[model samples]
Target: MQPILANELCKDLGSFSDNPQITGVITDSREAAPGTLFVCIKGERVDGHDFALAALQKGAAGILCQHDVEGVPQEKRILVKDPLDAMIQMGANYREHFSPLLLGVTGSVGKTTTKEFCYAVCSAFGSTLKTEGNQNNEIGVPKTLFRLDSTIRYGVVEMGMQALGEIEKLTLAVRPAGGIITWVGQSHLESLGTRENILKAKMEICDGMPDGAPLVINADNDLLSVAKVPQRLRRVTFAVHTDADVRAVGIQGDEKGTHFTICDKEFGSFPAFIPAMGEHNVADALSAYALATRLGLDPERAAQALANYSTTGHRQNVVQHCGVTVIEDCYNASPDSMKAALRTLADYPVCGRRIAVLGDMFELGEISQQAHESVGVMAAQAGVDWLLTVGEAAQDISRRASQLGVNAVHCSDKAEVLARLLSQVKAGDALLVKASHGMALETILEGFYKQFQNTTGVQDKIAGECKSWKNSRF
Candidate 1:
């Protein structure tokens, strides 16, 4: 956030203003330092316009509001048709000043992981600032861009959308020089209706790419396999299935971690390892490898960076509790992600019962039942000993698992799931708690830890371990 005057911001946004030396742009009144320009955004839970006076009272340079505030001095405000659009425009304007090489990433799944991978690889070359946490949407994207400083040599922005043209708006704001689409899948298919529509929505990130910028894509995805790129852009492809521009040979993963080799005749085969579970992460690694190589990093150096990088919170992080292992992958879920998590579960060495606590996979739309059933079948095929599913939509999973001859129970809520598992789940059991972010399955993980604490009378020891686990980024 290098400070820029309002006049300079207006030049970037292509807007006309009589007073152009506005100091800074802020979204929250709480974050409005003195001499800041506050942009009032209308959000789902709160409206920023309501806090205009509060921002002004805190020494805001000016207000970018949708409408006039009742008590605030009218002369201090810049009225706009839409404050969100104004924020985007201002972000674009602000971003253009620094001109860092922007790398845009999007896909139905693995966007965050790929963002982390890209950050890891790019950091080897120079200072890089990537999208923080899961900040990949319109609001999050702008906030991420605002964090950019003068020392950053590259900016990796993850773009995510559930509807058409959303990525286009973000692409316009980012004006990325390079872009990567990880893969197209059933994620957000409910909103976009079909895979074709999903592909179309995902490709919107390329709308603002420069004419000669490179557009990287996964060569394995059926939708992206035969897709054509714009004539002005160069295409680089990567795959784990077939020979491509960047390919991962001998890909392998276990409960401990995943190991693979990046095959490149020019740089020779380099072994890469990530202390994370799942083959999907291998795909994410490949995308990052391709992007980093394109940005002029040594293949071996980039691979080493990825190998040293660890998983972030709630995404396949393994926690050992009193002889039991819990794979806490409850961050978010989709049909594709569920299958990937199930595969990781299958990879774990099990001496006792293999258990799974799954919740609803939201946003499946018309295909919700079929998706759930497929996941149930997958659970059975993965040899899960006891399957506990919560939520109405996941009942299909239980039914399908039953048809496949797996011991499955459909719980009405988390309470019932915990009650059913309390007696059955014993020491040495491997449990996986997974669901979409809205399901809050992490609460169930907390409940399990509490039970372990109470039964062992090792509450202090367990509390210390849980605290360390909670603070652990991976």
Candidate 2:
């Protein structure tokens, strides 16, 4: 973000402050440096207000806090009712200084990947900035918007929500020129109550969108496929199986990557290869393709850029560890994502058993048990050789898989899960480790990388060293 005087932030956010020039903005005190504006947010475990003085000690230009911070000069602090809101307002103001074509992406799944894909595709057209890591919530989106500047010709922001109105609040802050809804799935079902409500929340991405702005959606998703688009919005469709405005045909996937034909009515058809293993990822590519086409970018160029698109860390990362091929997708899990990963594991060729180390999928509300069971059914149908389940809720997956005549085992914890997996996996076995982010299933992947080292000790290409979002959000 461009350096702004404290007076400007105070005037924009309606807070009290002197004219201190701020060069950067941050929330965590540890990340604070000289000329930084530290925002104090009250999270579940800790309060940022407690560390306001630490940030000041670290050369923060100012602190945005709800309370008066002691030890810091009064002129250096912007006092407000809510630090988060104040930061959001400042971010909105920061965004007004530039005119990058904004693309806001949100969905239960693939939003982050789709955002990255859009960034890659649009980078060919112009300079692009995308949401860093998993900063897709109200706090993260505004921080992402703060990154807008003259050099950036495009901004691809990912918007995530836990309930109704969250996406609305984010979209209003972004005021995107275009939007992409990757797909509506059973994520946050515990909070939103049902898939319909999730769809309703996801649709709020268009709330702050300008009238007649292009909105791209996944046509293959049952919830998004049939949703009626408002007349004020120009709707663009993308799908793999279903007929749509932009569709993928002649699709093919192997251990190397996925190769497919991207067919658009206006752009005709072009073949694209995404260095990822899942069909769902192919769907993500289609979502990005739709938005790029709407933005007047060349379809062929966008397709080529997709070939350069690398998979985000721990999200279907195909790697060879300990002489075994591991599909380490233990980032976040929902019923939809779990099924997709399982299907990818099934389609993935393996010289040995196709093993799936599954874990609990959180936030399903009353359907948590049913969701786990459904995943087990999917695992059985996918013909997985083994299903090693972790966590209390994931035991249901083991029970259901056993009932379906698949070899299933329920482990007590991550160590047990690892032990059972290592005992069964062979040299050519393809193992998929996946679960909700809360479960910390990545530990299993870490263990595989650490304990089961190959002669080279590190295959950087497949080792997944560039893991992001290591810190989980509640």
Using lDDT as the measure, the top candidate is 2
**Per-residue lDDT over 1-474 for candidate 1, one digit per residue giving the tens place of the 0 to 100 score:** 777777667554333244645555778899876768888888899999899899978888788787788887776777788776777777787887787888999998888888888888888788899888898876788777877888999889999997998899999999988899998988886788999999999888889898878788988888898888888987888888866787887666544477778886456788898877666788788888887777677888999999756667788788887656789998889998899888877766655678999988988889999999999989998899999999889899999999999999899889877777676765566789999999998888887777753253333233223222221111
**Estimated TM-score for each candidate:** 0.91, 0.93
List candidate 1 stretches off by more than 4 Å. Answer: 10-24, 453-474
Model 1 error, position 335 (Å): 0.8
- Residue 56 of model 1: what lDDT? 79
The lDDT, on a scale of 0 to 1, for candidate 1 is: 0.81
RMSD of each: 4.6, 5.5
Clashing residue pairs, candidate 1? 6-20, 6-22, 7-20, 24-37
Tell me how far the alpha carbon of residue 241 in candidate 1 is from the true structure, in angstroms, after superposition.
2.3
Q: Using TM-score as the measure, which candidate wins?
A: 2
